[model samples]
Target chain A: MESVSFPPLSRVAICGGTHGNEMTGVYMVREMQKQKMDKTGSLSVSIILSNPRAVEACRRYIETDLNRCFTSDLLSSPVTDSTPYELKRAQELNAQVGPKGSEEAVDLLIDIHNTTSNMGLCFIFYSIDWVTLHILKYIQSKMTSVDIRAIQLDLPISEAYSLESVGKHGFAIEVGPQPNGVLRADIYNMVKEAVDHIFSWLQEFNSGSTFEGGEVEVYTLVKSVDYPRDAVTGEITAAIHCQLQDNDFKLLQRGDPIFLSFSGETVKYDDEELYPFFVNECAYYEKKIAFHLGRKIKLTFPSINLTG
Target chain B: MESVSFPPLSRVAICGGTHGNEMTGVYMVREMQKQKMDKTGSLSVSIILSNPRAVEACRRYIETDLNRCFTSDLLSSPVTDSTPYELKRAQELNAQVGPKGSEEAVDLLIDIHNTTSNMGLCFIFYSIDWVTLHILKYIQSKMTSVDIRAIQLDLPISEAYSLESVGKHGFAIEVGPQPNGVLRADIYNMVKEAVDHIFSWLQEFNSGSTFEGGEVEVYTLVKSVDYPRDAVTGEITAAIHCQLQDNDFKLLQRGDPIFLSFSGETVKYDDEELYPFFVNECAYYEKKIAFHLGRKIKLTFPSINLTG
Candidate 1:
């Protein structure tokens, strides 16, 4: 007879790379798996391949976006309603990876991906939370080249669409902008190191060692960028300036700027408040999402979207 | 390359069954191994089958009793020392099952066993810690069929002389007066449940879950039980009302009531103020030093035979 053990406590899951062309997350998972966790007594981790087929195809899910598909509400529903195939899978995944009582309990979730254009080293965006945000600095400190910054840090994510919307915290770690093959290896290591850091922390804590809590930079989404898309690329290169509507619109403060710059230049045409800072740091083409992070007070604006 | 998990928060080494005759702990290990812990999501456990050959023999050890040889001084000596083979193996086994940091990090090290006589179900003699005592109850709660009681609910364990002592918080979970084979299934399930419980508690705590700790019963040792030997059956039974002596050569206590009842009636007696509660308990008969346990207030005692 098979003996059944309770659901594990701390764990790491590798996602993305569903498209064969997208290899960052898959490679990350492999590397994470290969790394030896000598402290297994303290922590138990299992590696999950989220989209094996999509990972092979090198493109997003054929029918839908898996990321948007996964959520508690859609997953727990008895019927599909108006959800797509990927949406259904997301529901299944949420059930399997959500919390202890629900089905699968996932303490931490990591989604990896390569950017479409030249961008920063690794920029992760998630619903900044108290517990999840606790060790965010530890991750940033371990980085050598790329600076780790949270989106919405500069612009407060509105109350309506805060991190709470996403079950737990999420990290959209951009492994630099796409098109740069050389950086992929470097990106792989950077992401791997972050994952290792999380596991290491878990092992220590599991062994009864504690880390200093507090000190998490909460990123609030002020609003999104809406712009007209070029005929060729269905996606619009985010426009510069305050294009968000005030009806439910909120904008980052004068100094706090966060937005995607797609024109391939630090300077946005038609003088406007852009995710305004350009380091010319890593890559020129990397369409980096700028942010004004590290403030205490939340900047609230009416409902808003920055999708250009 | 072999993957090594993080050093476990706690290690539950299930030995015994060294002699096929006392294959109690082995049964527990088999059940624990069968338990399915969502391998990658939470805590990880490792189980090792110690003394494979001896377990098949159905004897304690080939020549020496492995339990009698775990004294630190003896273990510190050269592996090739003139110590009994049992002592040598003890040296190896102790090092293998030695502590790994935190007090409870290696918490409950249970060695399961069976007695020569088949009278009772199961009983655990722990290091007399409140946590240990509570865990004893937890074990009993999971397996209620057996009468589980701590020898020193209020006593110390330093009563026995001629023994090398280890740390407190250790235990000997005896399974019977003799093996009826039915005990194996119960032993297995008990161990599996216990392992799950401990790991789960550790997991939730590490993940910031609140847990309530409890106190338990224990004993302080005062003296040892000695009996004259037999030449044929090798079973030396203590006569009822046997007087016991302290290391100072003073008559510590007088035995009024018969201590041990082997066949149908009283076989031995105790020398304490209160009669040792025999109550048809399953016990073994052998020409060896025996230890007595009783409850005491705020007491401290050695774990094994003397050299603590």
Candidate 2:
């Protein structure tokens, strides 16, 4: 209700549980606070336990991936027709945090996450700028286990992405490979370490100007993914990201062949299957191949552009 | 016709005529290119010449300042009623360069600009984050004359702005009081210094993570001096650094009185003599002062409520 309540002298934000399946970071922040890792000066930690509904229901976001829906365009939709409640929570929390988009003033964000691949005990991705350089050095001194990459996030490079789309210079530390108990503890320890790292460095590091964040290297815009649906039984697959990218007929083309039924019994294409219709030879570009030829780069899918 | 094109290995962007009067940066880029300032492989400078029509017609963009028109809501209708050409040009350039909102590859953009500061010598705005840290340090170590800041941008920090709207991360280097060859030379020197700094560093730095560029120290935003039509005429006589706190009004509230125009006959907020108003109150905010309030904290405009 208060428009501008006095900001705590120092604030720390640990946001997680966007996807019910990824609640490790959520509980970790809570447990970290529960364990009393915050002892430094006036440092207050705020945790946004997003998606209470999904967390209660034990689902990843019922309708959508919470991470992909934070853009300005998608966030502008007033109606919550098919929008998952988690995103609405993000929007509301965003409103509470500060102004949307450019006016947001997030000092430091430690978005805790867990990746599918069990690589890099934890990876700290950031733009390789000078502020980040000192941050990297300072953080590396604190965290010897985390893998940090200072990538140039521009052309001929991967697009850049912020941790939670909060639009500040933040990084997501992936805990482990799954939504298991052990992974949660790994995430908890990392967060505790991160908080300490921030506290120590921030207390002494005052030489630089304010921290301005970086551009995205590669865009992780996994807009939409198709799930397998049973026709007669009407049962949806319990898992995602597994069968989504396999030889599933969901990504059929205008003229490409489509095999129906898990046993490969039915055969169809543009005229037969009821999903992923390609209008032209350049229609289907969802996850199509984008490569280079002699002198030009070409993008091709079932029906989206045969030539560059 | 291409959505995004980077055929040139290096790019140099020049945005001029933002004020319709300051066209020095525009001509300097063109001249520098004629002299072959654009280098490939190590550095690619993309030139974004702004307000081509304003440059030719010789008038500041009226109705709406092109620089202030980069808001998300206004992207569709960048300019209103008048300044059709300016709007159209903006659209074309954005189309070519593509929106910064896209998670696609981007190139180095050095916007050339000229200012009418009856104050100090020329300065170059160094973007913050990873890349900018190097740029700033190198600029300081290499180019000693230019002043720099690492202000959080008013526009979306992630969304790169056109010259007209290169937010707080970017700087508006004021050359010698305009209308003099010295102003033109200052613009050239600044651009050349930036280009040179980037080139020298690229040899050693090669590339860095986009998000991890550098940190900034002193940051500031451009607070426009809004006025009524008939209230004030030429010659901005207000002393600089007078400090106007935009606390009372909403972020973009129009007709907010900012300055008092004095012309002997009548001192007015605008030439039209409309109702006097100023965003002096920022009523919604509990804390309204601009200076540091004791604790080691930074002011992220529009206070974020830690607790709901």
Candidate 3:
């Protein structure tokens, strides 16, 4: 596949609460809005609360997942399926932020989220695009505490439906171990720090800062594993094993307990070792996802030609 | 207020998951059914999964909460409101477990639940009935690790809508710091031990085991406190303060920090000393309950109630 690059930074959108209970983004946007962070930055920073009603209700969404409603097929339809609350919100957001590559669209978008899983502080990119990789490397260099385990989207980058998908340089900053609807001061400060750093980098680049982009280690998605369920009933009969409950981003070897039934039976991972993230996320309960399996790999980024 | 008593050695029902994601009871009931624990003891033990579909779905409930659907007015209506999934389930459950005071009705009910809050092990009684208090004392006496705090329902016993309200001696066991849909083996074991002890006590009592009930310390519900929110928008702006998070069943002094906002604003308890439980419960988000406040007090039970 050919590599893609980001253009010079102009407008940036910091969107939150695409899934309302993920309060990290919601509060980050709220704080930025309260403090008028947009006025201070040389770059035009638009702080967007993607689903205000869901944020107010402290739910994931009113009708359907806002994150999953932004795919190309869903967006391009003329007689749009605008009945669900999120689909309408998606249309409104796309019109406001992008249709990226369109005139007056944001150059970059940073969507924020929190999870109940022990995912640590990580950036999720849709592809191994050169611009996205360079930005990831820069952020990783600045924030040493950020885990090196970046997740590339399982679906093709073009089919990405997340809020960030509408922007030229869009990605999500997912932080957690924080429960849904409950914000933590530590998580708040960490997210704020990362957001501030991203904008600072953008400001420097806008003022003509360029660098020789290098290599960074990232994890790519393999597949997701669901909790143990009854063959006939299809109801989950076991939970993520005690040893692996919050062990997101950890390597799981063959024969390791992945689930534990109430009857004291243990189910082990029967395959080769793989890194698991988003372990036992509360929001993913609807999807019956216990965890996502991924593999770590080093990807080299060619020095980007920065536009002045 | 008049005190009520329970007849000795009648049918007993142990109900689980009237609100589904509370998995302690679900697992307990599943284990009992699998092992035929119901048949081992002389007592007529009935194991019921209150909302099987929700339990199967691993959700709180498909529609409305089944626990809140058992009011007398709801049960007595000639033309039933069976639109919501839970309402219909409640009617079916009432038909199966009780018409409460009828001959075939369960003599006692134990509804089990698990919470995300740090509410260790607790028993909630709908009324200040003698048999309930005696059972509470017996269990507290037997299990030294158990906290003595108890919550008396604010609603009149006649109007109680929980699954337990359908039994002559009905109460709830709520254990926590456990997340929804994720069963902790420790919590599962703890609930099973309690249920086993309760059954053993019942069997012993029916076989001429007699004892005088005594005074025990109990905590009664004062009221619930909601997290601070944006007045106009009604969106929660603060989280349970770090000091107060996981501080369930702990005494809150007159000036204790309760919540912390994104702007580093700390909101303190501006009232007399009180005990707080169910702090930062995930399920109470819909009700906007940050925590429930209560007061500890001593209550005595009459000894003449041994029906054998």
Candidate 4:
């Protein structure tokens, strides 16, 4: 990809509790709100505690997933008709940092999330934009120990409304292995680091420096693999095969055992070797996704001069 | 304590999903149900899928904890009067396996549970009884790798009514470090072994065998310890200290750090040394319990002739 000049970001927003049980983001936002760390240098920063009620209840969401409610069509719908809890929340949130083309919109949005899967420092983006690549490169540069991977959701989900879609440059940073609603120091610190780095990068950008040359391994979503379920009962009949359990980011060869039934039956993957993430995500059980398969690709961008 | 003769067992009940997210019991029961293994020789076994709704939702309970709803006062209340979901379910359960004094009541109940804390193979009893002790001894002997500890709820909870309380002889077996709703093959096997052992022992007892001459360590609950909280907001400010996060069933000395705050402040335990279990339990967050401190003591019972 050719190096592109970054757009000036005057206003930035950090959103948390998009999925309430993902407490790493909620606590990080709470800590920042409590400390009144609203801005870095001249940039105006906004902290959003999205889905506060769900966060209080320690659930993913009260109604539909707030993340999926970010589609343009839904955003254009009248607020009076938004009866679902998350729909109303989406409207309120969009009014704050959204309506991407509007004058009041924030220049950038950072939606924080956590997962039950062992996906470490996942940078998720709706579009393969320069801003997304820059942030991924910056975060990957600093956190060498963390398994850094960029995931571009090329599925129909591109039209799926997410908190970030409302801003000019919007993306999500997901960190975990932590169970829902439980906070660990390691994850909390990682979250803080990612947020802190974003703010620091923003400050540098506002001072006329832009992230230029870098390369990152990008994993594009292939398809979601559901757990083996009983044909009649629809009940999950097997678990993620022992060999593949917790093996996020690992390459699995064709014919690899993906699930093991209670009766010792094995379900194997029969396609080409693929890199998988979100393996055995506890939260995804409701969605019936055991894991998501991804195809790996490399993205290299040349150095560019960006001024804010 | 004098060893007493084992009581004859004609009926046995294994209860699961008493706390829905504890899937070790739920899956074991499901597996057994699927296999149609309702009898261990002469004993007529019944598998109770307690709190079906909560199990379906992958939550601990829809309302209050079902385990805590077994009190006679609550059980005696009408279904309409029992406003909570669990209260109504408890009444229904009491009708089936309870009203303990009735002839139709189950003679023995084995309620299984799993914890987020690192407690391994915990045998919990409300009252001291030979049946509880012997079961503990037998399981401990068979699974030496498991940290077998007996916990007697010496608090007002002794009358808090649990599923096991309905039977003449009943106790709860808790295994953990397993997250709620997620089942591990190891924990699943452990639960099956415990149930298997109980059924075999019952079969042996019915065939005129008696248990005698055994000693086991008992950890009597002293009190629950809460995590460090903000004095003004009452919100938890710190988490279980790093040293004690998963150190369930381990001795904790006074002056040792029990919690580590976000600000890097350490809150130390100031009381006498005690054994702590259920450390950082995800479900107990609602109850504000970081862990339960216990007094460990050894109990020995002499041999006596048991009759059916």
Candidate 3 residue-wise lDDT, A122-150, digit = tens? 78878666766777777788878666447
Between prediction 3 and prediction 4, which has the larger DockQ?
4
Candidate with top DockQ is 4
* iRMSD computed for candidate 4: 1.9
Question: Which stretches in model 4 have alpha-carbon errors above 4 Å?
Answer: A80-82, A101-104, A155-158, A210-212, B78-82, B101-104, B155-158, B210-212, B303-305
- Tens digits of per-residue lDDT, candidate 2, A1-308, equal 11111222244556666655454565565455555655455455566666666655444555565655555655566865776665676667556543334445354556666533322334343342233334445565667766432222221112232334453434455544332211222344455566567666554433222332222222111222332444664332111221222222133345543322222233323333222211110101112311100111111111111011
In model 1, the fraction of reference contacts reproduced equals: 0.00
Could you tell me how far off, in angstroms, the CA of residue B89 lies in candidate 2 after the best superposition? 1.1
Candidate ranking under lDDT, highest first, comes to 4, 3, 1, 2
Per-residue lDDT of candidate 3, residues B4-86 (tens digit): 33456558888887878777888788767777766645677788888999987767888888888888877765544547888
How well does each candidate superpose onto the true structure, as a TM-score?
A: 0.36, 0.33, 0.85, 0.92
Q: A297, model 2: CA deviation in Å? A: 73
Sliding window of 10 residues with minimal summed lDDT for model 2 chain B: B276-285
How many clashing residue pairs are found in candidate 2?
A: 70
Tell me the docking grade of candidate 2.
incorrect
TM-score of 4: 0.92
Ranking by TM-score: 4, 3, 1, 2
Q: What is the TM-score of chain B alone in each candidate?
A: 0.60, 0.56, 0.93, 0.94
DockQ of each candidate relative to the true complex: 0.00, 0.01, 0.36, 0.41
Candidate 4 chain B: worst 10 consecutive residues by lDDT? B153-162
Put down candidate 4 lDDT per residue, B1-308, tens digits, no spaces.
Answer: 55566457767888899998887788777877898777768787888899999999888999899998887777887667548999888878878886655667888888999887778788888877777787778778887887788888763433658888887778888888676657665677677777878877777767877667678889998889987777898878877777887788789998888887766678899998999998888877778988899999988866544553
Off by over 4 Å in 1: A1-308, B1-12, B18-20, B31-42, B81-83, B99-108, B116-134, B137-146, B152-169, B180-192, B227-270, B275-284, B289-293, B296-308
Ten-residue segment with the worst summed lDDT in candidate 1 chain A? A277-286
Candidate 1 lDDT tens digits, B28-105: 554345453324234434354445555544344656656555544455667655566666655555556552222533
